[model samples]
Target: MTTSIVIRDEQSADAAQIAAVTLAAFATLEISGHTEHYIVDALRAAGVLTVSLVAEIDGRIVGHIAFSPVRMSDGSAGWYGLGPVSVAPDLQRQGIGTALISEGLARLRAIGASGCCLVGHPAYYGRFGFSNPPELALAGVPPEVFFALSFTGQTPRGEVVFHDAFKATGPTPA
Candidate 1:
């Protein structure tokens, strides 16, 4: 049976839950450094979490997604990077992640964002209209995993740099 999920912008009260969910989601992923929660916290603290959202079911936050401004080497603006999307391990493949991504993308477009990009599994992101563009790249990331979705009909051509918060490996600074 599928439970109904409510997608909404995250509030301050949801910080700890978001962190817990994030940690649980990436806990066993071999490719993860297990620092997703820290990255989320750093983004929030740095004021660069352009779009932060959560998926709730029966008043419990089971999933979270974050988007932040990305710098394009070709001087392109209005583009954002998507990442660290997390869904509870037990809740994986239940559409919670999809809901968070869909709502987050809509929110970004509504705010005039030109596009969004991410380093993710090719098969997973392709269903959401994300594609790997030859001209747009994320250094050190396999081209197959770097995907972009252009909302404004113009895909940026250059290197994509996600926010520095993605490098956070410890507690948020005071």
Candidate 2:
């Protein structure tokens, strides 16, 4: 596990490994409100997925992150929303997830995305600059657990509907 793990764009061939990692990570969550596995499949099938990146150690996949298109309520702007980033449970806290997030955000920014939004623990994501901008709102998302960070441009306040896949796979939080 000491060898440097490489972060690279995911290929169609990596689908199974990706799913396995996702299942492992989501299982650790306190809630199963979201079907992490189905969401990834739907995102891939829907073609909204913008970035699919993976981490590997000695050629075995260990972590992953997916970014997809999202919009504000006003539709005034569009940005990539980060989600469902996962690392094999055994790999947690090894900085594998951190590398995936860092590299994925940089890639999204390089592609001209204005920002990234997500639902996650404020404490963990805050360390990476994920926060809810008072000026931005994704309706139906708890203002507390909901988080966002900008790469550039204004992130407007509005209802945030994560792709339909999110709903189909994970029950929406009331």
Residue-pair clashes per candidate, as listed? 0, 3
Question: What clash pairs does model 2 have?
Answer: 34-170, 138-160, 139-159
lDDT of 1 by residue, 122-163 (tens): 789999999989999999999999999999889999899998
TM-score of each: 0.98, 0.91
Whole-model lDDT per candidate: 0.94, 0.82
- Runs in model 2 lying further than 4 Å from the true structure: 170-174
Worst 10 residues of 2 by lDDT: 165-174
Give the runs in model 1 whose Cα sits over 4 Å from its true position: none
